[model samples]
Target chain A: MSLILKAFPLGFLINHDLSEEENVSRDLRFERENLCLIKIATNLRLEDVNYLMENLGIPYKYKNDNYFLNNGLCVHWESYQGHYSVFISANEKTLFEKTKRYVDLIKQGELLFKNFDIMLKRNTRDVNSKEIFYYCYKTNFRTRLDVLEALKKHQMENILSNTENEIRFKYNNKNYKFKRNNKKEMFYIELEQKISLVNIGSGKKSLIVKNLKTNYTNMDALLKTLTERGAFSVHSDKYNIYCEMSGMQFLFSRNNTRGQYFLSVDRVSDEELCTNILKELDEEYGLNIQDIVYKKIMERIKDKNMRIESEEVQDDNSIVLTIDLG
Target chain B: MGKLKIKLLPDGTIEMETKGIKGKKCLDYAKVLEQLADAKTEKISKTDEYYQNSYLELDESQHLSDN
Candidate 1:
């Protein structure tokens, strides 16, 4: 006689509802294959299997020489065996039935998920919970695009040259245009504000600036110091309108019977801020500031002294500094 | 004659062995298989025969006279 194994829901079994004919049929079939089937659930701990078997009154059996220890499920059985085989064969009909039950449970479990969703919604009502807004507010600084728009709106031109190498912005009032050579470098234009500045260059030496407009002579002395050390300007504007030397810029504006000046250096130090005002200037104003500064400083030194000697040496960090003595 | 052997484990790991080949020639022989499998060489062993073959000198006089 052919045995028809009625498959009952595992939920029905857990609930102790075995009164139906379907439950009786499923129970008989499950009992027959329980030992062999439990072996397939080895990843489920021994304690869990023992608890399940004891509760269901099923006996446990172990078999040696089973290759299933290394390779999981290597048994071949008939697909339509009214009862599930000793092996956990993922046949189409079995998978379809199991998947249907799983989907039903998942649908039923949506009530719990809905409660979780309500809790999350209630928690997010607090202002502190708005983390996304906080992050956005913290990072809402003016971008390059914003700066460019602002510069355009201000109508700052003439000194502003748009090129791939650098972006030049001329402060019309200050009579000096700031050039940003590299992306990380920032050149600021303070119309009437006095800013302290310090710059550490080649040998980690600092150039001190107290007041940018007032300390023009001190700034020139620093430039001369840099020139004597061989780090001179490769470019200079006609009439020394602006000095671009050694990757730095110095801007001088012609006034009535005099000249007002601004010093721009890449970066300044705390000590330099105490002594002088340093403005960072960029090269590429279509003038070789380094050569101009070098020649000007050399001439001044030669005029003061009988002989001048200069030598350049590259340090371990590969920075070349030329030293000049008068 | 030396032959190379390659075995694949259940977890997709591969073990390669060079059989009959002497000295570092085993490495040369297994290169193709290693390339095909994209295997990292975890360990390597040289047999006693590998060292013996290195010291074995050919009978040069016999070959010279024959030539």
Candidate 2:
């Protein structure tokens, strides 16, 4: 006896009986030899299975001794000639491909973290009032020590000697500021004035920050609102203190803040990565990915309550935010 | 019984339209799809059918009572 695993589509079994002699004759085409196993992958809920058994005019029984349901996939195994064949079924490989694609996409970022590469993306914007702010960025470390150094720097333990990336710092009050400085780029800070407010829109309470102030007028206001509402804190970089707020993050050296112009961290790079990720998903999965990936990316930055918004300005211009000020 | 049309929008959102349903029953039909998709209704439009059925039922009862 040999073992072979097969995935069967559940839709095919909806109204078909596999046990009856007549039914068996019809479904024998689906049966395979090697006397081992049968597996079915199904997206049906238990209630659906029961409903089908009762109302779908189909007679079917569990073929394998093993029965379990998980993550929209049902698995079962049948024994033949002292061997087993496993069967799993789902729709059009979409479920499998989608799950695999999702896992792969997440892993791509996670691998950066695991490998110790600082994968960073940043955006900046302005608002009428300083009530709320939101931001998101990613950086991967190359090694455990790199992660430790980055986190330690984030925690403001030891300052890095080189590279004046934007950093975050917390003042005496709960007030937070994100600062960054490059040779050519000026430094700026985002200040949040209040927590957040919930307003009814189209019958649902949409979390929003009414008044917000930012250093730049061209910056997206919705991004600022999300950052201000999200959970954030100050961390240290090698030479700068950084504010990590939701998804919008920046490092600031003390010297970078002398002027009043609130410089936005690299928005182009941030938007590019976002566009790349979405493009990749759309190309690979053939499914139009929503903001969920970006939302999850923002959520992973910190464990806190937050909201995010993304807006497109130009063909190459966009902004995103993560806030948990409430 | 009025038929309820529930559609999963292209954006992966659920939109529910209740035809010949009125009052709380419209909500009931909407809730069924809502529960199925774990979704919140973003916008709801009260159709002419809804208002017509609601008023027609009231008018029929009023006419019968007059007899």
Candidate 3:
């Protein structure tokens, strides 16, 4: 029998502590309150991520399935969703304090957490995308004719005469089409790529671009994507009418087979933008501006409500809320 | 029939507009929807509907009652 003398790699074993080392493969496990913890305003490397997680004295696992972070704050990283978001449960208000500490550490000397509510964009593509500004409003247009009349009254400039049956528009190299799905609801799809063009007045290269398409090619997939991405939908409807004018768009929707009248302005970025656009739209259509419906609907909906038409976060940049009065 | 319209914007703004109806009657039926959505009364436009005193809505000569 040959005896082999071997020195144990004690240092290697000590340094690679299984508990301390990040389980980059383990599916993260944590109860998400949908509350953001720390916003990584800038790009960071894996080492920096490790350093931050270690100093926080939290058990965090970031891998393929999920990113679970726990520092007595229930922190989790939302990286797979296009942007990197660190979400923490605001339970017992511990998230606020932890967020403050995180911001302080990241800033070191610069401004951080200026508006913690904003959730500033990072590479987190799923949420921070500025592409699709999906929004809806509660309108009282009884029929398609009523909507057309309002559009004309509001001076929707250069609208297509609709000599053709299919809804189509061409601006620059981009072509947008509206097609009815099996559910009979309209889906906006992009049919072309890019082409540079001269602005009629300035002769400058310009693209009259509007981001309207969701990640999916079909409406059903889009609904699924939205739900998985944590979008809240309120209600469902039977029929819908859509139109576009200049930088603005409209969707008149209904739940019943007969006249349903809800008006929504498409593509405005925020509440202030929506308000300002509403002002211009009101002036054109003889409207008296009152309140935003999302807040009201949110208030009316119980937290446990699971209606898909009620609300959806179109992206990190936009939240689309739908409330079917029917 | 006169149309009582409730305009709900994405930013959580709601506007009520009545067409072919004059006086406060334009807002009468709208109140029900307003309450259902839990919306607050922000800016009310008279649309010549408030000042005419007469309930009849004339097609010509639009008048603004308030900003």
Per-residue lDDT over A146-249 for candidate 2, one digit per residue giving the tens place of the 0 to 100 score: 33343343353333333444444333233333234443433333332332211211122222321222221111222232234441454443334344332233
Local distance difference test, each candidate: 0.32, 0.32, 0.34
Q: Write the per-residue lDDT of candidate 3 for residues A11-113, one digit (tens) a residue.
A: 1111222223333222111101111222232233444444555554445444542334333334445453343444333223346455743212222111222
Model number with the top TM-score:
2
Best-fitting candidate, scored by lDDT? 3
lDDT (10s digit) by residue, model 2, range B1-67 = 4544433322333344555556545766555444443345667777776676688788889999999
In the order shown, the candidates' DockQ scores are: 0.00, 0.01, 0.06
Ten residues in a row with the worst lDDT in model 2 chain A?
A: A119-128
Looking at model 3 chain A, report the run of 10 residues with the lowest lDDT sum.
Answer: A1-10
For each candidate, give its TM-score against the true structure. 0.17, 0.22, 0.21
Clashes of each: 31, 74, 29
Candidate 2 lDDT (Cα, whole model)? Answer: 0.32
**Runs in model 3 lying further than 4 Å from the true structure:** A1-326, B54-67
Q: What does candidate 1's lDDT look like per residue over A46-91, in tens digits?
A: 3432332344322222342111211122222222212111132212
